[model samples]
Target: MAAAATVVGLGGGAEKQHAECLPTSCSKHHSPKIRFPFRLRGHHPKNCGYPGFDLSCTPHSEYPVLELPFSVNVLVKNIDYTSQTIYISDPHGCFPRQLPNLNLSASPFQLLSNYDYYSDLSFINCSQTQDQIWIYRYRYQIACLSDESHQVYAIDSMSLPDISCTKMYNMSLPSEIFGYSYGPITFDHLRLNWSKPECGKCEARGKNCRFKNNNSSSTSKSQLLFNGSTECFDKPSMGAVLGPTFLLVVVIAIYHVYRSNKMKKADQVKIDKFLEDYKALKPARYSYADIKKITNQFQDKVGQGGYGIVYKGKLSNDVHVAVKILNNVKGNGDEFINEVQTMGRIHHINVVRLVGYCADGFRRALLYEFLLNNSLEKFISTDKEKNSLGWEKLHDIALGIAKGIEYLHLGCDQRILHFDIKPHNVLLDNKFTPKISDFGLAKLCSKEQSAVSMTTARGTVGYIAPEVFSRNFGNVSYKSDVYSFGMLLLDMVGGRQNTVAQNTSECYFPEWIYKRLDQGEDLGIQIEVDGDAKIIRKLTIVGLWCIQWYPVDRPSMKVVVQMLEGDGDTLTVPHSPFASTNPMPTRGTTGGRTFNSELEVISESE
Candidate 1:
């Protein structure tokens, strides 16, 4: 009985440690407990806190100071976790001196002004005279004995005079603490409020929360999850003790059988549920026999990719359609359903329409309108085809893609973020009009939501936004697609053959393009003629604007469309889309290094 009790106790202790192991900063005196979204810099890893929430613990002091934007450091007095507010005070007890020309432009926090009163300070440089009678009405004067000519006074007011003060700045404070001042009230605290962390939602559901690193995966962003249990352990069963050797043998046998059966059942259930949900959607469903009849037994193979094979087909009414048969299904058919769910809800001229689907047992396929021009990939990847399509046609295709993406973002009932936006995904009809096709890696969310939590990285590597791979760049949002679109435009300018362009020894292709454009060099168009230079320049500039490192710096799809459609002469060159460490070479030499691959593009099955 003692041994059994000991075993259960150890198990419970392990569970407790797992749940409570989140990095924390505690205080011996007054500071509040700091954990997620507020981690001590050296004491915790960055994932344990929000991006800008870097708290520094002074060597021997119990208080932790938070550094806000513009390097303003404030000693944290108290933190209200539920309210997502923090009370801070000047570390040296000199509020006026510490907060001169204060600016919170770049920080995540906002100053909370709950009071009605405001104090305006006027700095004067004049001899003390009876004309300063109004200065007596205000609070104590701040002046140096050596500088008798200058006088400064601060007072609360609804309105102030247009006096000829040398300098002036205003400070707003809560009315409760705005007592009649004889001296500067330096001990008053400032309240700051931040939107509650996204992880808070996981905790609200009664589950333990932890940030998961997702660099190894290609589908989701690193975010919080409700996977771990909040409680230490489940209660052990109460029963008579059996012989140790006999119990151990029984447990081993049962575990092996249970694990095998659990694996089988889980996989089966996942596939069944996926298909059930796919059927519930409004799109038409076709049987395998019907798919074979439609495609004429896969006779005409138009394209083949890693995930599936595409064949040209025609319906009974002689309406031409393309059938994509998914051949290498990795797991439970989530990718197929993701495409179905995403493409079904969308309806736009620039967005490819999903006519129907085929999910007969293990055999699955998608039916789309047959496009004669194939993909933009063929046109951009080869020089002969690119010139044949001409720069004018390419510009229109880029505009079409932008319009499609804009409609996906704002025109829909819910915002659809296309994680993967590339040239191959853009298909052209017989008339050369482009439509966006693939949606296996799409995410949908409300229009009001600023950012979406992803479990792993999505989109191709060269095109992936910095924030999508690492949160240090910024939050992943609709702008992530903008970054990919920027890469797409750059690819268009480079004729798609020079994407990532390692042959030139350049770290990034956009840097190379920027140097050419800034120097007024021809973009090396194979067939440069009248008005061709302006169109190429417009695409390059718009692409650079879209690929800014920070999501905030990138323009929206609507603005991108306007830039593309408007006069190219009015457009300005954007900041070079290259990191400072890899500065552009003034000599313009490749240094003989070649070969570049950004996680290898996952080619769409036509």
Candidate 2:
């Protein structure tokens, strides 16, 4: 007994860990963490912590912070050392930012709320059984509870919601529970409903039985027997067969779990290969049937447009996705590519993420995270509009749009020119956060040059700057986008579309804005005396500066961001925008690179 005890102790004995982590910064300000006095030889080596990880501290906040660069923030509110989860204040402003990016590659997160996990459903015609199912599944989705790890529930001190983005009184989660396991649930909890039972194929000699028929009054003695096997159906005693049937059910459930895991592994492998090759774009590819299942046969149309109708759908148990199937009449091939290429590489908080795409033969589609609120155009340009957004929201929208465009211009290796920048293209999120989308007319410029090759003029008539339509103005540069952005800004300030044209040859409203600025007058757009007038005036001035016919007169997106952010006192009144009629000087070349310009004419993007 003593020898056995010694062996067990040795088997489970604690082994020393081989890491020594350091603090982010030294307490003394001028003195670095490892300076002249600190030893680098005796106890100091660079590789002290985990491999592929580094420590850094920033002076931006009040106290020094120790952080892992690519890993999740370790400033946990409460931690479960055993489960390795920390209840943190809403870090991502959604839910707890899972550490090591969560390897629930194994056990799926369980819900406590009823069926309401994602976009709430009105359930115009839902099944009666669903009412109680959700109650067992999820706890109430507290609005914006970012620290919702199982560990957080273990502790009760999750921080309350932050209402700075949009005021909300209570908790509200954004997805729904689409299905359930009537029997046993799997580990990952994602079993595609792809299996079927073959009761019709049951053989009589193999002891098969039908769902007890209640129609016929006359029954065979062998069929109705309390215990028998030899009969017309070779049916065994009902009691004896039930145990086998229950066992079969369990076996079937196990088989389904295996099949589901196999399918998931296959799908994940494809996604991994896709990420490896097409690292920038993450487009969801749903089978046609999956799309149909998601949208419930296109029964619920959220928004209709010239190109297509947007149907809201949930892809997974918790993933809310928007499926945009190209309308039969409006688009076809390259137009789909236009959006995919333009949105693929771009990722920003202010921009809508293109999750995935699909282009099976005869089908063209694009998938994106569903933005709760629609376009900014709808709110501002509605009949009897309220204009309750006030000035702050408008200012925020302008800044967000500018930042998005700036990302397209400078964040990517190749410069992206949003040829169509307007109120209609700016969408609002759940919190009225702005996202830029719709890139059918977008163009790409080489990293080194300001000019992009174009054979034919593109973009909406009103939003297109003068230089893009005319060559004499100057080399069409990144400033063209600046011009378009400025026009959008002016529209936001105008709070209406610049729809009126004196003739086919003129852009009436921006010209009107410039004239008013020249005479030191405010834009005549019907805006009430709200506090946002200051931001409106700034946008108007900046927009006017942006639409200057010569590219040189337009401000870069960087400066545009600064002007939007800075106080009104720092602003300079804009000069009159170059009119289409203005005689422009000769323009420069495209720096010698030549490529034929093409327009993406189809709307199918996935």
Candidate 3:
């Protein structure tokens, strides 16, 4: 744990500051020392510790607590300043419970490298009866997280065991933990190491580390010192001894600064050029002031994503809109250009309307017509929500989304492929009409082109087609979107993420659904009426058809729309799509068919 470094002299003032920052602990005997680069919150001044290294004491237990990014607080067991390592344990005593949301990228510390000291561990939760039968076969069972009804265990294998167990999650842990032969896994503590502040060498040399510049104010000095501006010294006279070396360091620093500024200017020029070229699209451009007014200073936050935040706002005519403010745009502004240029030329009932855009300086935003209902994700995320929409409504939503994808693929003058199409991206209007949004990952190509060349895979993990990741599956094409829509339809029917392992040992849920349908078994869903059962079966069959292993084996969006709108009795179970074993027919057929025979002309490149 390294706190922000502070600039101080080796004289009287320096000695006073050091005395104030003297190592202290939550308890007199057991607690670890907290000093430079690590400070107790509310007890030490801001300059005493480095940024992101602040710790607090538990009110009742007196145990030191370290809160990581994303508000995860872990109890600090020990701090080895000499080794630059901090040992922590979950405050709730179950580290596995927090593994899903544990993020270390934003924090100063990092887990030990996976190649050397760490190994991957998969957690599986199973019923008590199954646990008893298989518990002796596995290495460790997390007793604290287990109960009478179910038991949780960790295994070294990446794939789930061939049994009725639900895969909870996966994480990397110390390699030594899996080697233990005797007892249950305690997960007693985790070791995290930090590289910043570089105080280990100073500690090894038995010398104190302090910021080199003593003339600046404490706040500014902390900022600079955190950027590796500190020096190792024993006394005030050491400064005079190191003056020449310091001067050389200053020269190198200046050169690096000049290069950084030059690069910034070049990036700015590229952004300006992009904005200028995009002006021809004739999208309504609003100033930053207008954005603030329209959003009421960003008061109503509607949603958030990796690229930006969406806020609910109103136009001058009182029409509601969703304003997405983009953040951390790259030097090329490729996403902004793709979204505006692609959405600007599109107008369809099932596609969200881009009302306007803002390119004020470095800040950019996209305005869209606000939908009353949030997204399709909210309605089909849980059992209750899924039932609230009923089987018929869910069928309609599936049909609407298919039509939207059909419009993007065939109706547009140029074909538009939505690389990312999941439940979250489909917004719902007041009438619950689905509108496909988020065109940042969309690609446009000539109508005659069948496949699009992709340098990298772009889409949500579970929803992405197999071809997008590798060429062995097939060339990337509009059929890729059909694969995603199929996954979405499965989620709507299953009322959960389709990628999750079902009751069976199979890793893929679609395979399980296919097996059930092949055996003519009920989908184990709560079907309110006979019609509901047919809708569920129909959605499942169509979804399985769309997610075929190869792009050629999957049906076109046009056929998908027809399947969803047509009677459920006419649909047929598709070939097993788990592996690239069975290739479906290329022409018109019940399972799947290509919409354009000319588009089937295969090539290495689009």
Best by lDDT: 3
lDDT of 2 by residue, 1-606 (tens): 000000000110011111111111222343223211111212223333221112222222211122221123322222222232223222344333233222221121222333434332221112233333332333232233323321111111133232122222222222322233222111121111101112223332343322233123565432322112221124334455445444544564576467556766677565444333332323434457767887779877777666677788766544566778875723555666565766766767777788666665567777777887888887667424526676677788889999999988788656777788888888888888999877656776665644566778878777787767886676666777887888787767665646545446555677766766677775555566665567777777778767767776666787788778877655666445555545452222112211112212212112
Model 1 C-alpha lDDT versus the unseen true structure? 0.64
Candidate 1 vs 2: which has more TM-score: 2
The residue-level lDDT of candidate 1 at 493 comes to: 77
RMSD of each: 21.9, 20.1, 22.3
Q: Number of clashes in model 2?
A: 36
Alpha-carbon lDDT, every model: 0.64, 0.50, 0.73
* TM-score for each predicted model, relative to the true structure: 0.48, 0.52, 0.51
* Candidate 3, superposed: residue stretches over 4 Å from native: 1-282, 331-341, 497-507, 580-588, 591-606
Ordered by TM-score, highest first, the candidates read 2, 3, 1
Q: Tens digits of per-residue lDDT for model 3 on 449-529?
A: 456877789999999998889878777888889899988988887776445555655456677778889888877888776
Candidate 1, RMSD to the unseen true structure:
21.9
lDDT of 1 by residue, 255-307 (tens): 64675567676765654443333222134567799899889998999987766
Q: How many backbone clashes does candidate 3 have?
A: 6
